[model samples]
Target: MNEVQARQAIVDAGTVLYKQGYVVSNDGNISVRISPDTIVVTPTGVSKGDMNPDMMVVMNLDGNVISKGLRGPSSEVKMHLRVYRENPDVTAVVHAHPIYATSFAIAGVPLDKPILSEAMLQVGVVPVAHYAKPGTTDVPDSIAPFVKDYAAVMLSNHGVLTWGSDLEQALARMEVVENYAKVTLVVNQIGSERGLSQDQVDGLAGIRQNMGLSPIVMPKGNAEVINGTDVIPQGN
Candidate 1:
């Protein structure tokens, strides 16, 4: 992609994620693959709502800084860099802490349940990685195994990781994660946490695979829906 295009993609991602309530303040980071070894990512400590194209940082796959200005690389650049190295098919990555999805992480529960047909189709069963210190090797390594198969994984005791062939596709997947979590949360609150039927869930998976969306395996058996309320058990 052209430099202008790459830069705008990051800027646009910030605005969209922020507006969608997927990310608040400057809690998330976004990046696009500019080259095989170079990734253009948002800088640290910047509010997503007003991030400018010029503030994004360009870094190598090793997380080495190639460019720096008013904005510095995000402290979590390592998380983004490791993804680029391990998943060649991924062209963009988004890290966000939307409350609903993040609720699973904070609860120390893996989102392995396939409650939503659309989630199965769109994201499959989101896995939970073991807890690791943020901005460290632990977090990336935790997500490595599922990167090839699952487009999104919940960071244990942390947040969420979602990626795609491009920034828009990546961001769209994140939106699904956010919306699904929101719906799931709300459903749980009213004392109804029942997931879809096995046949219905499978149907959505089939549709997703045919549509070229992420291929996620629909977990068999009944799912315990946690609506928008806290899905994770107490003291998790």
Candidate 2:
């Protein structure tokens, strides 16, 4: 997409995230790679729901501003930049604090259960990065290990980050993360979980490959029955 299209896409994505309650007042960020070196990103301190195309900031891979918007670039731009730098194929980045997903992040649990077949295919396993201060270099460092293998990762005690070949895929992955987290929470409350078998997971992996998505590792065991109190607490 060109600069104008990228800017509009970011604005549209922000509206979706806001309407879906994935973000609140100035609580999330979005970015789109317009070219190899140019990126259009949401500005900081602005409600995602209230963004316009002209409010998008244009910046280079080095984080140098090509055009300043009405406000500054998102404070977490470094984290978004880290994703693009780590995965050359990623053209869009989304970072948001969806309730269920952020709860999992807060509980220090990785969304690794293979119980949801569609989630396994679309979102893969969302691992948790070690806790790092937000909007800092350390935040980028914490997510580095999982960036190459995963489309999404939960920021420990923070939120969720997703990236894909384009803005639509990236946003879809973010939604999947929250959906998976909600189902997983329900399973925990149900006190029994039936994760997909190794063969089943392998089958899904093959399907994902056919769909041109990167392969993800799934748990290789049978169903699990959790009788303990490992459920994440109910809160954002």
Candidate 3:
């Protein structure tokens, strides 16, 4: 896409994330890769819901400002840059603090259950990276391990990040992550939850493969499976 289109996409995604309550105030950041070396990102300190195309900042893969606009690039742009550098297939990134998902992150939980088949097929398991101070190199370093293999991940004690081949796909992944978190929370509230059987989960894994999706793998066995039950903890 052209710079104009990329900027517009960032603006639109900001609005969607804001309207859907995934972000409040300037809590989230959006970016789209315009070329191997160029990216357009949302600016800092602006309400995403009120962004315009002109407010977007253009930067290089190294996070250097290429086109200075009315504002600076989001402080978290380093995370986005690291993602693009690690995964050439990814063209867009969306970062948000959607409540349910952020809650899981804060509690050091991974959304890895085979409970929802659709989520399993599309988003796979959402892993949690260890906490790193946000808006710093630590944030990028924390997420680097999961970038190449996982489409989405929760930042421990922080928020969530999702990326895809384009802006729309990235945005959709964010929605899926938030929805998965919400459903998991509801199941926890009921005090009883049953995950898909091993066979059923295998079936969905086959479907995910058929759709050319990446397999979900939790690092360090962070996901706890007991007696055929995938345990999603209710954080205190």
Candidate with top lDDT is 2
lDDT of each: 0.78, 0.89, 0.87
lDDT by residue (77-120, candidate 2, tens digit) is 99988888988899999999999999999999999887888888
Candidate 1: regions farther than 4 A off: 221-236
TM-score of 3: 0.89
Most accurate candidate by TM-score? 2
lDDT by residue for model 3 (134-223), tens: 777999999999898888999998899999989998999999999999999999899886666666667777877798876765222214
TM-scores for every predicted model: 0.86, 0.92, 0.89
lDDT tens digits, residue span 26-81, model 1: 68899999889888888898888888888888878977788884478878777788
Superposed model 3: Cα runs more than 4 Å off: 218-236
Higher lDDT: candidate 1 or 3?
3
lDDT ranking, best first: 2, 3, 1
